[model samples]
Target: MFIELDFQDNGKQSNYQAISTLAQLGYDGVVFSRTINDVITKNDICTFKELDLKELDQNENSSFKNLSSLTLMKNEKKQFRQYSRLNIIISSKKNIFLLKKMENILKTYDIVAVFPQSTEIFEKCIDLPTIDIISFDLSLKYLIKIKYKQVNKAIINGLFFEIRYSSMFKTKQSQARKNTFSNAINVVKYTKGKNLLIASGANDPINLRGPYDVMNMATFFNIPFNQAKNILTANSESVISHGVMRKTYFGVIKVEDKKKIPKELEESTDEDEDEDKNKEEIEIEKEEMMIEKN
Candidate 1:
């Protein structure tokens, strides 16, 4: 089983800590947060702002060129295809040149770009066969307005009681909340060509629940167990491997002799049998001696 954590909303830990936690959790990879802050400071992309329906460009002086060169050099410092596949989040109104530059960086690591649910932005940029992890955390009533139905996977980010309990239980109105989940599930099930994924939207590792815990939430909302597991496990794996190159990774080899018997108790049956045989022989010899004496 594999889990893909969406860490776009979390900021409590340093970048290294978050990455290390994913490694510890046995998560295949992470969907990293890429807001306006990281790219500008890291010199990944040219900055942009929107005004009156046009995207105004920024100055690309020698400093910008030098920074870009430095970033590329730093990128070259890493081994080719060294890391596992990871996801990067980007919004709709980002600069096109900057977006392309980001794509190049991600391509080195074989990262998947998860775009927002904007038709215009998707059409302009999502040209590569990169995976689309659709966001469905919007209200059930508003989610129906989204135009794209051909996403790679769908994420029910904040569906659990820990996140939605206030809206669900505040006024003792269970039916509406139940209907909302049912509607969302039906949309996911009936969507023409999209896969379903569920996430906790957890800011911390403690908020991440086990498989059975997620199943209980699904059961309470009348969702099937298999469906829940798919969202929680299978779909996440699909998203992680979507854009990455495949490799055959053979693990570390044991230096011990293969033909030797194992030291475990289950493998020690031969010694036990030998001891029993010796006891039986001794008893028979004693009986014969007793008969001779008689």
Candidate 2:
């Protein structure tokens, strides 16, 4: 499974320490969600094939030139090539100039997806190639509204939810599980497009869930197990593999602390896993009952 780290655009924790931790946690790629403002040190930026959209401006030709310049400057030493993939998220106002700029950006980078938050912008860019709407947490009702409004023309390729905030908001993990299941079901019912991506708005490694756990969550939602696996692994891998970001570590998981899995998640699975376990218990009970009756 291909795991990707959710790094805030502002580069809040964009450091080698942070990247190293994600690499250790089994993230294959890193998606820069917003405009990363801070200048990361050379060592940190070299960690993986990371992405940024700050250069996506309205000037079509200038945008490509600008991307090339940034790539040249940031990866002159080919530090980014060591990682598996590089990607970009494009979203902006729907002005003609901005549209031109977006076209230019698309020409230069292998855009992983276009994240449109505003209705106006989404309308203008929904038909563009390789675009996906970022589904906010448990906002299935909200997405349903959006799908109806867009007449199913919105070319969303995946769904994403914030694990960090949602987990905290629910306080209990079980509640979070229910919310996740409901959200997925809603999106599946409303979505016209086909890919469903599971992501943690992980500013750091702590936010990521293990591949097995993510799959288990999908199983709980009754989402096809393989499809759920794709959300975290294969889908992200495809994005990174074809994206423009240079690979830094390539295949190696950047090991920092040699950390082990936490005891709680290790011992106990989530709601879906528990349900399967319950099914087994019931089957065993039925067999015992048959034996007694006989």
TM-score of each: 0.44, 0.48
Q: Which pairs of residues clash in candidate 1, taking residues 3 or more apart in a chain or in different chains?
A: none
Per model, state how many residue pairs clash: 0, 16
Model 2, span 1-294: residue lDDT tens? 355434444343343333444444444445555332111112222233343323332335431333343344345442222222112233434231233323433333333233444555544444333322344445322422344334243422122222222343334566565665676666655552244456655545455566666677667556677776666766665545434321222233333232443343234334764575466556656865897999
Best prediction by lDDT? 2
lDDT of 1 by residue, 158-253 (tens): 111111212333335566566557655554544422355555444454445555666667665555777667666666666556434311211223
Model 1 RMSD vs true structure = 26.0
For candidate 1, which ten residues in a row score worst on lDDT?
Answer: 48-57
lDDT of each: 0.40, 0.42
